[model samples]
Target chain A: MSDTLDAALRLMRAQAALVRRFDARLGGLHGVSLADFTLLLRLAQAPGGRMRRVDLAEALGLTASGVTRALAPLERIGLVSREPDARDARVAYASLTGTGRERLPEMLATAEETADELFAAPAWGERDVPVLAGLLTRLGGTGLRS
Target chain B: MSDTLDAALRLMRAQAALVRRFDARLGGLHGVSLADFTLLLRLAQAPGGRMRRVDLAEALGLTASGVTRALAPLERIGLVSREPDARDARVAYASLTGTGRERLPEMLATAEETADELFAAPAWGERDVPVLAGLLTRLGGTGLRS
Candidate 1:
């Protein structure tokens, strides 16, 4: 493999491992999957803690149907609510409820803890974080916007 | 979010974007998804170009049933075959066929090109490649063993 391909393979493998770790940790601690946490994080940062379904789909890299399916559980648990857009009846927004805001801090804490453990591994030191983050942000597009 | 969590989130987003891009390119050019490419890569590197079903599942971070479901199409296309283990009738290995070997180079080329485009972005200088790879290897256990 070319050097570039070699690096790409390493990146992909690292992602798979980290994702598995994050998913497990987040799910066990917060009762939320990484995907769900991502959605909630995005919602938490949105204006008024609400977003249009289509916008959420785009931001979360989920399809419209995928956004709907993922939101079902959160909505059922009162963490999110479907609110009809007043001016456009056909358009509905997903609004973060008080419960979701309440749950987010704990979930965010778990995410931070997971990060600390993973990055604190002997293989990585303090200096490496920014380099990794910069490369990922460039590759990921939209930077840290999500 | 803490700096660590912010980095982690960026990494996750990058993985999602790259995976989507790779899946689209691989599927379009080779009639294989990124997950399928990963499986084939693992099989090709395994001893005798084969691996047990359970091993495949673990390496791919997929469940046993997920591996089975993913393999059915490859088996149908004659790119992969199920081989019974002589010592254990209950054990079966997934092996790459000659045709699969013939097809691998082209698919690999596509992956390389995808990596080139992604890494060539101005955000990643030549020096950043090794740093990124090293950090990812540390973060992603087993490194680039796949």
Candidate 2:
């Protein structure tokens, strides 16, 4: 905890807050919560339009139970269709239906605009963007390098 | 969506995963959970080891309710003390406790390593961190900018 450390915290705090805002605005614009929007997009883009529950859970950084809970809204909207896996009855396959595929493009577009806006905080100059990203990347190294 | 839009989604997905990983690893390395850990550090570095709940909420990008909930654990652990604002009874003040002040340095050291490790994603080289920070700051500009 020196002055440099204090300065780093400000940058890290900004980095974390920006990511959360990206989700909020993106979700608000799309009329779909960020978490739900991601689920829809993931299912729509997956091969065969389906993914195993466990794999989907991993992709989402959620526990299996968290995914089940999150799926309720998607299922209610008919955007998601979950079924017993053909190869493994114990596994459930979650896929995007026609409605989800149709809605995804619109949501995706709004989301990107939100992302672009979030990426450009005025307080920090344009040059600050990539510099902070690089510094954060270095600070967060997994200890495999110098 | 066009190819470029899809690329944005790809970036969102990758960054979201990295943030979650960063949070998880930070919590694991130290006994402090991510939310509590961030709270303590912010409080310690604030003007007087205290700040308005709304300001903290804004800084943390958490909704009011989310901030309230996050404060509960900290308060319970005696790391944070909550008091009704004399100027505005409806508002609450969250101040770091003496214990919290003493513990801040150690917690931050843990964060330094975690932040460094996670920011070191191969995708963001040393030179790219500040640029990403700037972009993320801009990204927070539109909407609630929460």
Candidate 3:
């Protein structure tokens, strides 16, 4: 394989491994999967603490059905609430509940810890994280949120 | 969030987006999911083109059940076969079939093309790939194979 392709495969595999680790850690500690945490994080950042389901799907790179599936557990736990858009009844939005906002910091902390552990290896220097993040952001284009 | 944590999240989200794209394209063009392609790639690289199910699980960062589930379709399609170990009756190994070997190049080619398209953006220069791959390798440890 070409060097570029080889590098891409490595990146993909590494990310997969890291995600599995994060999911296990986050789920065991906080009862939230990585996907759930991501959804909550996005909702926490949205204006008025709410986002249309379609936009959530787009932002998360998930299909409409996927977004619905990911939201079900959160809704069940009262972490999120579904509301019809005031301007358009056909449109639904997912809003973060007070409990969800309260719980978000702990999840973010866990995610941050997981990230620190992954990058704590001696092989990764101080500058690597930012450099890598920039490349990933460029490669991902608008798919990755700030 | 701290810079390291932010970088990690970006990497995770970017990889997720890329994998989804790969799965869609590979599934549409070659009838193989990205996970399946990874499995086949691992088997192809194993000695004698075979590996224990447990090892496959470890290598893929999947549970034993997850490995079993992923293998079912590949086995049904004659891409893999189960063999009882001579020394351990309880252990079964997954061996790649001739048909699987025949079909692997096409899947790999598709993956390569997908990688090319993703990195073709102006933001990624040729030098960036090795540097990014090196960082990912460090983060991933031995979990990521060549």
Per-residue lDDT of A26-58 in model 1, one digit per residue for the tens? 889878888899899999999999999989988
Models sorted by DockQ, best on top: 1, 3, 2
Interface RMSD (C-alpha) of each candidate? 3.6, 6.6, 3.6
TM-score of each: 0.92, 0.73, 0.90
Identify the CAPRI category of the predicted complex in candidate 3: medium
Q: Candidate 2 — which residues are off by over 4 angstroms? A: A1-30, A116-146, B1-30, B84-91, B120-126, B141-146
Q: Candidate 3: which stretches are off by over 4 Å?
A: A141-146, B143-146
By TM-score rank, best first, the candidates go 1, 3, 2
Q: In candidate 2, what are the lDDT values of residues A58-81, reduced to their tens digit?
A: 776667898998988888878888
lDDT of 3 by residue, A14-131 (tens): 8777777888989999998888998999999999989999999988877789999999989999999999977898899999999999999999999989888888758778888899
In model 1, the runs with Cα more than 4 Å from the true position are A143-146, B143-146
TM-score of chain A of 1: 0.91
Give the candidate number with the greatest DockQ: 1
On TM-score, the stronger of 1 and 2 is 1
